[model samples]
Target: MTGTDTDAAALFASARERLVDAPRERLGDLQEGRRFLGIPRAARIVPRGTAWHLGVLLLTDDAVLATGDIVRSRAEVRRGFAAESQRRRAELAAAAARGGVPEGATVHLGWHPIDLSALDAASRPLALREGDALVRWSAAGGWMPLARYLDERVELLRHPPERA
Candidate 1:
């Protein structure tokens, strides 16, 4: 890899390594726009027409850097990821049954809505430096497996939907 690539990878790894099981905040306990440092507790993949998106990818960067819904540690990150994934899986299925994920859209890591229908205009997707983009994310690394992270999360803004 190029020096820059190597450096970036190292930087990403260091950030991920720093994450450990620590105290975190729950989603409902969070404010609308308040900023705090925390981990990604769970993620909801809301499907628009052409892409899948996370209503919010709870973060775990640090209480000092940012905040929202918090996941305690790296383990919680994994657990939340899996749990959210399962939850969204069912949600997507139902949505598909009702309408369908656009003609070419596909769901990777998906989850059910933390709430079936609710829109708090004050609620903005949290942005944290992960992988190459600062988007609402819920993973240990900047980049994650398939639909878990990567371009999918970064491009979430491009998609639109009611809720996960």
Candidate 2:
């Protein structure tokens, strides 16, 4: 693999390891009560045709590497109206019923890698331009370098603040 490819792969691996190592409660917090990673703990969605394109900022390099999926809105709605809490679960189940993917799918069944740069406005906040470093955003932290963001998140996951 080329140097850039190797670096990107390493980045993905390290991030995955850190995420896996985080305490279940912390990971759960990050996932915000979601049942599957494929459902994205956080994401930006855009509607296109019959599907809603789903994306989450998982990692980054030259381009923002994301876990992406396409959910058929019709199918998901057909399953029944989901309250805000159960939306993701309903989408995942509906997607599975439709074979978990459309023909010529760019994203596979699992939350595989996808270039967020290829997406439209949804990618703006996470885009890594030429000669630019990667970053992530949170309401409290705003924009932070990707490496720093990962480290901080993992550290917080390992040591959460005690609740009152």
TM-score between model 1 and native: 0.21
Which candidate achieves the best TM-score against the true structure?
A: 2
Task: Give each model a TM-score.
Answer: 0.21, 0.37
For model 2, how does the per-residue alpha-carbon lDDT over 96-153 read when each residue is reduced to its tens digit?
A: 3343233223332223344432423345334343523344463354554445655665
Candidate 1 per-residue lDDT over residues 1-164, each given as its tens digit = 54433443444344334333322222222112223366432333333212112334423242111232212211111224357766544444333323323333343322222210221222223222332323333444342332244234334433424593
Off by over 4 Å in 2: 1-6, 24-113, 116-125, 138-142
TM-score, prediction 2: 0.37
- Residue range with the least summed lDDT across 10 consecutive positions in model 1: 69-78
Best-performing candidate as measured by lDDT: 2
The RMSD (Cα, Å) of candidate 2 is 12.8
lDDT of the candidates, in the order given: 0.31, 0.40
